[model samples]
Target: MARSSRSSAPEPTQGRFRRILGKTITYGLILALLVALGVAVAVAAAVRNLPSFEELRRSPTAQTIRLRDVNGTVIVSIGPNYGRWLKVSETPAVMRDAMVAVEDRRFRYHFGVDPIGLARSVKVAFERRGTGRRLQGASTISQQLARNVFLSNNYSMARKAREAILAMALEWKFSKDEILELYLNKVYFGGGSYGVDAASRTFFGHGAEELSLSEAAIIAGLVKAPSRYSPTADAQAAVGRANVVLDVMVDAGVITPAQRASAAPAEVRLASEPNQNSARYFTDWAIPQLDALIDESVEPLDVWTTLDLDMQRTATASIQSNTPEGAQAALVALDRDGAVRAMVGGRDYVSSNYNRATKAERQPGSAWKLFVYMAALESGYKVDDEVVDEPVTINGWTPRNSNGRFSGTIDLRTAFAYSVNTVAAKLGDSIGYSTVANMARRFGITSELNTQPSMVLGTADVRVIDLTAAFAAVSAGGKSIQPYGITKVSTAEGRTLYERAPPPQNILVDAWVAAGITDLLQTAVNTGTGRAAQIGRPVAGKTGTTSSNKDGWFLGFSSGLTTGVWMGRDDARPVTGLQGGAAPARAFADFMRVAVANRPVEEFTTQVELPQWQLESDEEAYYGDPSLEAQFVDENGQPIELDPAQPGPQPRDTPGDGPGPDTADKPRLDRRWIDEVTGSGGDNGNRATGQRGSGQGGP
Candidate 1:
């Protein structure tokens, strides 16, 4: 065929081949250069945003709130725990080699990224592409450190470029040991632990410097998947993973086969689980109180609390042993100055974080009688004052004793000993509910109270801590106290940041009243309902059982320690055969039996003398004049209002206008009832002993 003028004659085959080859080489080189330029620009952009090498080398450690007991023993750490930063030289050689062997054998030679490993991974992925196998990541230790410290795991080309650039920068500015040290201290291990030292301490119950070969291997294996390989989560899987790490160590020539064979599964012993729940409830309660003491925002604190670790252990054991199955119990014990010595908020803190002692507000039941008797005593009523404990109804609400019967015309001390609800109700009706509530407030009862007659029978909901603190006041010889836990707060370097000052010693009740109430509580524990709490020593306490057996409580003091215990279901469901004297009282006894063993025995004392007593006719004594409405007056005998600083429900606009028990059917008082109610009385028991540090007048 003839060639057209526009087309040249058929070119030589050799010429055509050479022309194609030249064009191919030229175009390929141009594309390659363009790609290289783009990569260089991306690298430059990433490297420019990175922080200085000095800043990167610091390896910031996460701070956490650490709590210590009175003995300075660690109670708990509230956040991710980071031990002291460990240098590469400080880390055991076995641990270092294991990490390098399993994570990146080429770590010693690679500048930052391992191209040969990446190529190998890519080849393997391509070979298994149709087999549903995923692409393996060839990121070296440096790349991991870069991503973890300065970048995010975004899985984008830009992020990879930044990570690679940052890794290179780390290598360029720091030595190989410094880079490894930063990585070792910055990587997160399992179980809320950060850094290699923390991991070693957590897993091996020792420091990173003390790690053995097997333990080191196990810890190194956790870097890939912490939760999956955590020894605490799966010991067998972790040991298997550690065996794989040993194999890699052997292949990398970091360890000989004979050495690997010696590191058996049995040699990989994990540390026993820590006492995390030992006092978790107490720490939870003490955490919020930090905001008031220090600038927690500036740095973490090491709170030196008032918790007696031994007593706390005993209290937890007592509650766990005595509390009925399917029910929960809370206990709070305080020193004379209101320092919380030991506290257990529930049966199991993990199963339920609800702090029953500090948070739950349930009826105090007969334990409410502490305020009733205290108010009556402060109002001039004696422990020996005669009161009728009969089937009495006021405002249509009849306060029945737990025994369903009464002692009928019993002394106040006797009735209190047996926890007579009828006598408490009559006192509430005669003294006025507001007076009782104010008395509770004076003693630091900071719960909302119902000022009705039933409230006198312990019908108001109150926190265990508040009620315990109130009783602590009586135990402190009428000196009111604010319950506290944290004694001092300091920084990690032992710099005192905040220390608790001595709480104000505000007198809540009269010494005579305190002595009188002590007499009543002594009677209750010695020969009455609280008998179960008797530790064969001088113990005085009260027992309370709510309606339908919904709640049970025992509060008392002995040898300068006051404690309160409450037992019931969280749902407020009735527990059959449950009563304050049975479970709570026994728990108190079991706890006190050990808690106060070292404390010296102190006999209770009184300064006031009781007047001559006589029983009156049922007509005149049982039914007081209906015209006389109950009144509460201050020291001047004038009417008073509720103190706003105290935590309690304000009285109704009409003080005695609530749905209280009818007065007509209640006790009949003498003409001098108001004036005579304030008469002081003597304690029937030993009344000449000294109080704590007084050598006279024991509470």
Candidate 2:
């Protein structure tokens, strides 16, 4: 009975131990299941808040607008938001290797996130949490791309979890090369540059495929902190970063130790600074037109413009060197077809954005004489016809020559060459002011013209561009011109958005009229007021100085090109000693000297024949008229006969009371010519004309 009792007690103790062990195992399993469930819930929640992978894949990237010169050299870039897009095939292997070495050394072996790197980051975070130091991120290339494209850069557990989930999704959807390509294009480099392509061009002045090992390393180092690592900003730090990348590349067996060493000390030749070209005036002028050419739905464009950068430099230098103190200058050059080649809007575009070439409306002064003379030629008036330069008055306003001394009875050609004020005024009054205004309009003068007689003297304001275009008509043999700059616009993918075709030729002036005027202007440039503007070529130009010397103008053209230069104070105050024949003419000459150096010299076409009337004397043509006493007038406002027998000034016949001269015997003038001479040809010899100076006279 005692053996039975001891055995039964041992069995009870054994049963209790077994039961306690079983309960302990059960509770442990329950706790493990709960923790696993909680982790799954957190991960699921993070995934739900992340952007959809398909949406991110389909999103459009911002683009840049590149403007190129006529020679296809990039002058400036407009929008640099996402920079230029480059495919994976376009990226050089060395550049890609450098990026991987610096950014994610284990990028090839890692799934999406580097678990070993994350572990180290976690340990470091805990150590530095209380030390006021920033915690390092453990993002692989895929993780970085996921965050950059589909998630914010917010540092939080939730954001980190979302990044991991999106990274894994990207790994599942794309190849390693695809992920790397997207990461490179989406990454931001400093200086308003994004993507490997843009960054390569911005730093090396070359494409990504042309990047040297040293350049690749430097560019790769910039990924960590673009502005901070930018060589332009901090060369020493950027080089240090590049050396670290080179060592990593060596460690990864991507490059030899010798290559790393060679690359580490290589000098980084960064690209030249942008906006160094003097094309801002043209770019600013073209901005509005560029915008109009592109549609909103189209991607960013590449515009090819008609700017000759070399000529632009020449134009800018000429204007800057010749502009006088306290004065501003503007210039515009156009090809024969009216392509704006070079334009300098002011002395310095930085100091002032006011484009004088296209904007300013100042009096053209005697440059306006081109239209008046054109009117006379069209009116059957000969350039060599006699016109008295003596002082004249009409309705109490007297006109005087620039020298303040009249050279009586000068030919129209000599009068125009010297900018003789009295002759031009009398011609305007005789032909009527309306005739001169109409001629100006016919020649592309868009400015409003005052009907007063002074309008012929260029008292009316006009734009420099319009005046330049009008001169282009004579250079182009009477064809009207509209100045244009852009030639073509296309997307980066080579899709044509706009292309300019040759504009139709529109004739604005008669060929004979243009030829006649071109001849007279050539004489002016060769032997007259515009003599300073001669470029050792057959150039035709006119010189003008406004009242008080407020504005000086030189409008000239060659057979190949036309250019206009204007010098004046912006405030319209007079510039002392400034004349169109001086600085303005010299500026024109300097610019043309460089512009035409490479072009073949050509002479002006002489297409017009001299009129028979111009070849004969007035005495032989009208000597035998019965009413010669009523037909001709002298300087004293008295009728005179062709014969000396009736030379004494005779009283005028009563109005319409006598038989007029036989029409056949009289050398009949066109009614327009008759009215012109009969109304204003007679001179008032005793009138006092106004003060005048060199090159300061009527057109």
Candidate 3:
């Protein structure tokens, strides 16, 4: 009876074990079903936010804004580096092998996520628990592309789940090759480069299709740590990473042992450094104009500019070489039609982005004399007219020459060539300051001008580009010019975005007046303060030196080109002994030498004749008496005809009033005597011949 009871107890124990096993199996199945359902719901939610496959494929990447020179050579790329899109078939086989071997060996077999890799990563995480180190990522190529394109790089469980779900969607929608192609084109390779194409061009100076086996391995190795493995930043580490990629490729059977060995020691001739945008100043000045002309919706534009790269380089070198140490300088070169050829805003663009050429406004000094002299000529004054250069006062404002010594009576040509301040002031007062300011404005001087006598010597401030364009107008034969840099803008597909038409040539100044100024300016370059700017050609220019030498300028033009240069301390402090005739003029000459080396030497047009009626009208209109024209008559006193057909006198041998061959046979007149008697020069004692020195001097 006891044996029977023991056997029965064993049966009950077996029954209990069977019940426990059944419950355990039921709970396990329920847990598995719950996890699978949760995964399905998560995937569906993630997929709901994803874009359509076609939309994702058609989405535009960040395109580069390329600025090309007149010759279509790319001078600057202003946006992200997105190289030309390439297909998976277009990529080199070796690059594919290297990438797969190093980044994801199971890429070809996985459906977005690799179960084995994920399990291994989990095991590694468990083993490395409490080590305070991040666990390695187990993302496949599709998963990486999903993260790069659709998800942020956040180390959160939600982000990872979304990445996994999106990766699966990508796999379900595309083939392995398509996923690989997308992955290769979307990865960041650091240094502002995006995708394999840009990375190839940036690091190897070639295309992805042109990469060698070793080069392919090296670039592939950068997937893990691009900045850390940059060949440019650290060559040895890059080589070491490439070796690891080669070993992996060999183990993966993508390359043989001998091939790996051959590729391991292969020389990686990295491409040369990318062309830096050295013409940053010109680009900065030109971009605003470009933007204004083109619609904002038009993107990825190829801006064709008027920049002459050779001239731009020459201008940069000249400014750096001629500018005094610790002083800043700017230069702008323009064609006769006001197309900007070259511009250098400062000595070093990397150190400072202040574009002085278009933004900086400095006193032009004697460079402003061009407008004053133009006004005088338009008012019936001739180059040979003798004016009193002695000390004079206008409304209690005494004006003196730069040398602090006065010439008794100097011809208009001599006075201008020497940049005589007193002569300019007296002429400005006689012709009317309003007329001078109007002439200046007509010549494109946009800055406000004070009506004071000192304005004749350039007390007002003007931008270098405006001054350059003003001189360009003179070079273009009295036509108005709007300085422009971009000639045309188009898209990559040859679609015309913006085409710049030649602006109308509005005649601002009279042709005869412009010619007269040009003649006097030729003499200025021939023997005056602008002699340093002579380039063995017919150059017309002026030298301007401001008070305390704070601002120096050389505004000049040839028959076909015009250029202006300014030099000063950026802080507006004095540049010690610096003068326009010294540094600015030399820089102008140096830049012009290179700018016109390949062009023909064109002479200026013949001086135009000022009509008799025009001269009579100006004389009567300005002096308020037609008979006053006789006061400026020649020695014979026959109401000397001011003929533009006749050539002016040669430049004076000396700077001041001295005996020289007078071409016009004009008589010396103390214009101050006329001013005092007519109440024109100003309300002060205007001595025709006196040396009184007690006042603040002019520039």
Candidate 4:
């Protein structure tokens, strides 16, 4: 075949100039071909070295988190399933719709990266005349998965080039399902939780198995901008995102206009507090225990605990809401097996790592009476046994009641429930200070209990954590269990890293004897100083308001949990009108109500009472109501043994409603903040220590 008309017609112009021009054209064409080949080779090589794009294409970008009720019913979460996270595989229809709606419309048609999208983005940037080009990312699910799972925060051109290469590699390495799983596991949804697994539980309070369309939409929308679109952070933005996602789903033909219209913007329900079940409070108090348990050289352990999420929520809430002003609070919640489910050391965990629940010693005041009575019980004393509630003195320490007037004569139970200082002192004196201290230690009192008479009234300082251990013994039916935080811990790839068992010890008191004390604690709730704490259930607890009213405490227990609360000011300048049973109780009650709302109601395991006694002494003869007896006995109503104790949970009944347990302790560390070191009682936050010229509140 003769050349086409155009090829033949262009051969005319001749001579040396034509020959040189022809030669140059031929050379230019060759050079162009070579350049194109090089570009192709380089791009191909880069893609080959990158992630496996095919694996990423099938990776999951959208996931659901579900929070559930105790009965395993989904309550809330990021997506529709409530408290569950559903992988794309679990709900492909939703995932496909989400992918097409928000990401690449031609995902299946493209190899991980989309050159057409990039070119279009370049065109838009040129038109806009901006140096920094906005993204019109056409990365398929596979490419996104690759970047999310294994990429850097670097946004330079080099990083982008690397990301593209990695994307290809990921596609090659993982099957669609595997890539999707990695994608789902790596993306963030804000609210401080990492991974889809953690996000689901954090937002919806459930696992990955449950989710609804609405919930899924909410979570899926978070992928583009997790923090800004998070339901917890901006409900309006999240709703806007949900609407956009719905529209996209409809456009993609995944859902009909009617379905899109029917999709409602979900209401986000989030825990008021963050970082529950991390054992912030207990970590401080249990430091020694933890150090003893694990080797320190390799960062000790990456551990997990059997903490109940709901229970921990309540603990933090209680402390945050109820802690007295200027005070820092701390708390720990434990299972009967001695696992610390939740802990809060102070008001703001980020401000300081000091765990008030486990660190920072504070006076127990009347709260310590529980130990005195426990000591009395161990010595074979009956709760109803007569004790002179008169002037009690020891050396220079003359312990007196706030009222400075005693009830003349009272039973051990009566005094304990009332937190009568004089009576507690007498009981401790009779029991021997050494014996009482030893008993306290057995119940988990890690702090040194003073041997002085004032120690009987809880005068010696005790950390809230130490108090928790002592109380846990009471709840565990007299078994002395060491408190443990982690149950089991695993690596991101599911490799087991650590595990924990409950702290173990023998029975500190007879079952009946322990029950007897719990019984009296119930009375404290029914008609003692802790009456303010009663909330329509059998709550065995104690209310301790320090003499200065600076420190307030309410330590309580239920069949499901044991909680200790302390309220005081960071400056130690009394919380003014606030006290233990209020802020702590309110916060505690808030958490407990939600935590156990779906669970069956449970009761304490104590049951024993004392017979009404008629004292021969006139002072004893008029010991209140004869029918109102005191004593810790077995089911048969007799003192099992003189008791020993963890006085953390003393039930008190009084005239007024007050705080509940799980309260925050005073921010003792706050006062000493090196960043802003100062004295106590001054607004400027710096003053002379002894001049009484208003000093700084604390550091």
In model 4, how large is the Cα lDDT of residue 227?
53
Instruction: Tell how far residue 464 is off in model 4, in angstroms.
Output: 1.3
- lDDT (C-alpha, whole model) for all candidates: 0.78, 0.77, 0.78, 0.59
lDDT value, residue 342 of candidate 4: 72
Better of 1 and 3 by TM-score: 3
Q: What is the overall TM-score of model 3 with all chains considered together?
A: 0.56
Would you give me the overall lDDT of model 3?
0.78
lDDT digits (tens) for residues 249-327 of candidate 4 = 8887778888776767665454344543334434334323433443222221333445455665666666666665567
**Best TM-score among the predictions, by candidate number:** 3
Regarding lDDT, does 2 or 3 come out ahead? 3
lDDT of 4 at 490: 39
Model 4 Cα shift for residue 245 (angstroms):
55
Worst 10 residues of 3 by lDDT: 685-694
Summarize candidate 2's per-residue lDDT along 149-257 as a digit string, tens digits.
Answer: 6555556778777777777666666778878878888776766676788888887887777888888888898988875678765577788888888888999889998
Comparison by TM-score, 2 against 3, better one: 3
Worst 10 residues of 1 by lDDT: 690-699
User: What TM-score does each of the candidates earn?
Assistant: 0.55, 0.55, 0.56, 0.47
Off by over 4 Å in 4: 1-304, 501-505, 608-699
Query: Lowest lDDT 10-mer window, candidate 4?
Result: 690-699
